[model samples]
Target: MFDRATTFGEALEDPAARSILERYMPGIAASPMATQFRGGRLGQLVALVPALEDLAERERFFAALAEVGDGAPRPPYDPAIAPDPAYEPDDVARGSAPATLPGPTPLWEPLELRFAGPSHGNPFVDVELEAVFTRDSGQVRVGGFYDGDGVYVVRALADTEGPWSFQTRSTARSLDGITGTVEVVAARDGAHGPVQVDGFHFRHADGTRHRPLGTTAYAWTHQPEALQQQTLATLADAPFAKLRMCVFPKSYLYNADEPDDFPFVGSLAEGFDLTRFDPAHFRRLEQRVAELGALGIEADIILFHAYDRWGFADLGPAVDERYLRHVVRRLAGFANVWWSMANEYDLLWSKDIDDWERLAAVVGEEDPFGHLNSIHNCRPVYDYAKPWITHVSIQRVDVYRTAENTDQWREQWGKPVVIDECAYEGDIDQGWGNITGEEMVRRFWEGAVRGGYVGHGETYYPPALGLEGEVLWWSKGGVLHGTSPDRIRFLEQLQSEAPEGVWDPLPSDWDMPWGGAEGQVKVGYFGFNRPRFRNLILDDGGWRIEVIDTWGMTVETLPGVQRGQVRVELPGRQFMALRLTRLED
Candidate 1:
């Protein structure tokens, strides 16, 4: 029997309901398109699936569904968490503090000002709260967000070490006219602030090199507590410095489980309250961001994506604007956060180019720290030439060629090119999720040698391989069962030895992708091609050469220094590279 209010996901759980669905639309259960709507109402699926557009067919399916209905009670919504329309700001405390920011604030660390504001109407809609922090260097105006219960929080940071003063201005009378002073101090050791874009590369606010050796686990935060903890533990030891994760819970293949909490006040069954946020959810997410920061990993937070069972992917322009503003205000304070406007923006059919432009502008404007900003792609690439975009974030358009195009991308944009999603090292049914570990390591080296960075993902689903259920590392973020990560660590070690703390492509033959500071430190990679021996021209004397077996993780130093059209011996095997370090003169 079926519940009239049963969702596409709920129906799948009911044998009779699932059978009814299969009868009406054969193979709909296994359809990738249907899988995306597992959390959506049955009625909503008709609008998305073209086959149900017919009036007769739709009515017939509905009649059949009704015939099996037993009027099962739908899940009840908890009224305690719902916002009260009659609520108002408390009148207990009035007046501004001379120093709202705590004394002796660390540089580049955000300071907070909490205020009680009018809650008669939807503060999220009616209120506009911003604060200006001024110092001898300059001033920065940052937006604030409503954290429910009539509480508004404004956060700002001082880049320079000195005395800084701030004042608040808002639409509500209660929140306005607040003032503060902050005694900014030097940052502790190793606190390199937010990552900023340097021409064709990245460096921290303090000028420390940031090489983005990243990986993808898009919905890790939304997973269960135990799994999330395990993911964090795995990341602590992994070589990746950046994690590309999503703000919203995903609804796709191997990601159909319902999260305990959502960003909004309600659930898919009862309809979410778009105006109010779930504080617990945001708090948990913020905690995760801070945890990743502690582990020296940047959080590349993706705000939107097409994979949705809840209506988050299709939230109207107004809701979208409000949501973006709210998210930026809440997370911008963290130095580790990077604003990825969306992942696979083109695949989100509801948002057009104009919508994306407007949304991106909101993020760029709201973020006071101006962390790295970029949007990813599916098939069509966003124009990285746009002034707001700090760098290029790409998903490979061609199956056969991804990292190979890094040089062209770098030349075209003159910004750091990141091959964020070339492909995964997995054995899944989908082509995007199934590539060999050797191939994955090859892609990383390929991108690195061409002066671009690559990201890694795994999707191994071998039942006999000691995996816990169907938890795939690409989305669920459990134990990593891939061979590329260890190899990637070696690659990171090699790249870290660069004289400039990063590599730049040097002129070389078409067959070999070589990069580093010329006449100083250099690496030449042979991806799949194997040759018996290679000849190289060394400009200066005293160069030490080493043969690197990428897969075997071995580096053997050659006998002595070679110079001027030298013949370098090789193992004549695939996944090999050569490194040359000029001996100190």
Candidate 2:
């Protein structure tokens, strides 16, 4: 039986009053509030007499509490407990291959547990924890839960100075209880004499887990000869089955004037004459593809943006449909290649076209080989292209300090989606610009894979010779840019290692929960009542679990509840993933 009014008064008296005040009345703290009492008194409440200030504060605070009423249950809170730091990796021998870590098993296996509770007042916070073990060659391999949703594996050189510790934090919800577990195993590797694995498992009554859905690889837009060789070497190290190459003619066209400035060009103008389109560069690129194929990489080429031409205006009516068809035919000959019809057709609207229909029509007719085609849509117009294109590619931008429009795009276009490009602004002081390498990886996985999208698409960290150097209209100018060979290898490995066709269980309708009408399942948060609830049929073994927050940070998980209908809070943007397994008979 908590007293709301008393609790409110006590809360005001506490040292955390400033935070609470900022939360409830952000402007009031900075600007004085004008109040008119029962006697028609007029004054700025925050600036007047001290006695009135105390009285007004008390009254405003209690009035807020009165809305909740006494006996309102306090939300869950879990405190942060430091993880055990005295762990070491199990040693492996000098000549063995890396093995797949065991999957999450039933509670019977020996588990090393680590747990942390919710922060003070936040209803939700992300829960991320990992365990690391050292190998004989001094590399440290890591396995852990990322943001309490996706499980990841990392191979890195270990620090000899100290024992490793695992850390987990909830990105969204304030959890009541926290727990973790780990089990160690010894194995051998060729490069490292001995390798150890600390098997990890994480659980939260309110959290869900998601497995990697698919893999994607990107081609560097431009590079120095030495750097290109280095880039190819890095690509060789990645485990990607599919690779995307930015095969636009614009790279050659833009660099033609400054041939010496071209990073990987043998002879820029010679390789890129529209009338006599050279096959030499394409041949060289093909050779690279063949090299990648030996290492298990499949290639997809950007068929648009040749010589700065994306759509009608850029290519112009003079080029005619015949030339386009010829280009498609030549590209289709490559056994390892697939066609990405356009770099971003949505931007074509500015090129004087009313719609994308004309462009799609031309490619549809010209592509006789049935090359797989997809369109990259500018961030604001992805949904508009859904009906026109075979697949949709989303370009995510930072609108506020947060990832802009992801939840909205997912809600609107429930199709195969890819994040084609993403980045913070050039100014690092802006909260949005401070994204980390780790956060970038996390966002890509969450937005594209776990969010039920098709694949994680990418825009390269522009080089000194490519679009960044010439396309001043959209360049960010090195604020937070550049990708190393190691970065590409990491992405390649992430793509190759992820699972395929992972299920995403977001109900088709956000406002309405699925009710079991014939063969659907009902889903909604507790205490939210609506007549139209349905259940999803698990007849096909294709079901995977995902949770969408109707509101930010607030989710409903009942005690002892294995399965039930529940609604999620959805004010701020957030989502969760749960790995679904078939029930035993």
Candidate 3:
């Protein structure tokens, strides 16, 4: 979705979306509220269309909404009611009076214990609190911090299921020496623990392969409520598995508007208190992170980025560590969180590699879960060789050959490769923000075959929405306009359909070919390369092949041959791929 906050009118920017909304609900697309819900992230505007109540019509509109933005729940097509002005973190529901510990604690889920202390001086600077839990498996100690409004909290994650005892210690009087006990229950369905690197691939702590089919909606959570809802709705339905976004609000290009909240307690005119935090803002982020987890999406949070007018981009090293510590204590407990140290880490003229190293150390020390971590780059890449960096979070070094370098990185870094930013599919004036959908989709295939991951982004400019220059999915969140997301979903489905082995970089005569089981099964994509056909010879013989048109979204299975060589005909077009598997005896 694109940012539609500052550049909205009565009607939705897209004619088709407006038409569908008008036809269904008659006047919703023209209402005063349409100024906001036209992909706004405020309260969700699910207009219940009485006319579209028929199952067929409803399905048609549902598909249309998904195509335009995100699919709605069974709809009357009415606008969703906005929540109260005061926002609280949306958390897991439990059945008790205190709402803190009314039930068995789920494994990998955050368990928070409240502590009250005398706030003598600067509570944020003075208080030091933590909870230690000892189990049959081992002993675990976690550091806690002071929450504003005279509150202090200690949080911990139970890694094992067994009898456990706990103790709390703090510099504050009442908070010190508190003790507790809790039982660790198995994780609920779809909740895999934190992500880890398993050799050349990524997996959950519980051993689930994590295919990071990612997208870069850099400030989706920073937009207004309606737009945020729209972004969530769009993601809830897309096949994307990971979302890369910034914790600090962006202030560049199409992302000039201020975010709804700031992570630190500060304002633009009057500077910020580096030691203190804006609780509501962090709570909102926590809520979004949880929602993403529910949708099977990893929250790849960029803790810092260079784009800023808000001084946040230039926090002193000590203050930066404080911000990192606060974020780790509050946000790292979630199962689907990934720590992206910074976006374009080199572009921040104020900081150096050593500064990033220091922040990474802070996150490393505080995040007990050891979630997947990396630093994205704009120029030279930060050393993934460093033990702290779990995987490679890369922005394209070269426009023409970005994702094709995946296997090379894997070989060089000996870790998982994520081409987090190859480019976007759009007609924008910027080179990075605009490319054909076909090229973007081709990068996805190229990355996948190389045993790595690809990232998605869209920057289609819709001037008709009066945005002439505002709102883009790459920065702000709004309706999806590019053609790459669906095709990438097809690629994901193909990856899931692999039978014998997982995809890997094949050392074949063709540089683009990727396969599983030492080339027993291969998938090759010819990106921007035109060849009518390729002549192939396999030692194993018995080969079944299929042609993949990444843009046309078609898969054509060809006849199998139990021979040494075969002539494969291609459309001689860009974004074309091939799938070959050895027939089993």
Candidate 4:
């Protein structure tokens, strides 16, 4: 019998134990690290690796070994971890709904039909449910998911205002052959529907310009209830329009606490049931997404990440597909949702490019709305030229050159470049987490002028902000203590005033980063290069000039309208920009 408490040399005699090592720590069978680890207790291998020191990681590693070894307890099923599904059938027939239920459902809002079906056996894996929603424009096929206790739901969105009908088809007898009708009405005011790629930029479904001023708070939802509420309250006033948040609770540096809930059934002390999902966890997520929408923010939801103490990141191909489909089925109807395939996806070493492509295909196939999709990178950037990729989500590959290459990447991919993880403004010990507030503000302006977007994060040590625990703004979504947000807000206001299609980088000197349309507007940002006076090449026309103090949030206009090829006076300060607006005669 294999034993984790015994030395790995003894455990290696059992082929099953060796196989477990090969599965998790690939290449370890022939690696030098194995030789060192093999001399110690098999369970002590985690201690050899400094990165796996956390309670969750330790529990996960030993549990894996125990699962394959002797006397392994059966997989756990905790009732508290599983909650009642969020569906209740009304006075309708068993497999059918009323022909017309309600009137004038808003455009792009979900129309849900719940049916009581077979709860026996694995309904999650056994049942297949789908419905075709037909309207005046066309018919869209939407997939439905199995909620617990025999409840199956078919949720669909109507883009046009008209009477829409839907009929369900399922493998289960009780779920199949259901029919219903909903009256689709005009979209509510400020309801822009989902964001879509518009050439090198983004726009809403109704063609409104959407420049993504995003920020990252990877595990905000997994925090305590009070902290989650605080995060929402902070976000309500912050200038960020999009949030890069993770679907799974993160397990990494400064993030060791057991989450209030998990996506799968079972506790961290016990392993999760891969076949089942925690519906309450998803319901909480939905409520958070809805709340974010109410505050006019887009949820750039990350589906996978490598900072996992749970085994969600290491799920097999079949289970991965099932999980992806399930998430898409539930959240696709939300107009504010954007699917980020993963955060630093390459860090998930178990997966390859092919695996990512298949998962992306599942999202495309399952989501009827066709929400924006992209994968973030840690080191090797994913080839964004793939047809399925809507835009490029990136973490700077090189330190010191964060958002400076925005224009180059935009040209290379012919897509919008979002620098989602340019080093954050913080006082932390890690280099990636401790850039100055001024530097963060500079990157924001630099990226904006180059026809790209940059994301913000904060990692100030908790005590520095006079708080108790590790509640950094980057991962935990606590209050922001950095000075970048106000400057970024100023930058956003300037961007909002500029006309559409204005911020594409124009030909300029290597030192100056500038962008504008030919005859409308031009903004030249002199980042760190504080020139007292500079000659600007402009079209021969009357122009109005304003010197902007990006840091101070002040705009000063010169004496009068200036003509072509003028030498403009500047403050000779860092984080200063010159704006030129063509004076229409």
C-alpha local distance difference test of each model: 0.83, 0.34, 0.74, 0.80
Clashes of each: 0, 64, 21, 0
Clashes of 4: 0
Q: Lowest summed lDDT over 10 consecutive residues: which window, candidate 1?
A: 77-86
- Assess candidate 3 and give its lDDT: 0.74
| True-structure Cα RMSD, model 4 | 7.3
Give Cα distance to truth, residue 308, candidate 3, Å: 1.2
User: For model 3, how does the per-residue alpha-carbon lDDT over 411-436 read when each residue is reduced to its tens digit?
Assistant: 99999899999989888799998888
Clashes of 3: 21
Expressed as tens digits, the lDDT of each residue in 40-81 for candidate 2 is: 111222222233235456356435444543345644322432
What's model 2's lDDT at 296?
43
Using all chains and alpha carbons, the TM-scores for the candidates as numbered come to 0.84, 0.41, 0.80, 0.84
Q: Report the C-alpha lDDT of model 4 over 262-292, residue by residue, as the tens digit.
A: 8878887888887788888988998999899
Would you list the rank order by lDDT, best first? Answer: 1, 4, 3, 2
Best by TM-score: 4
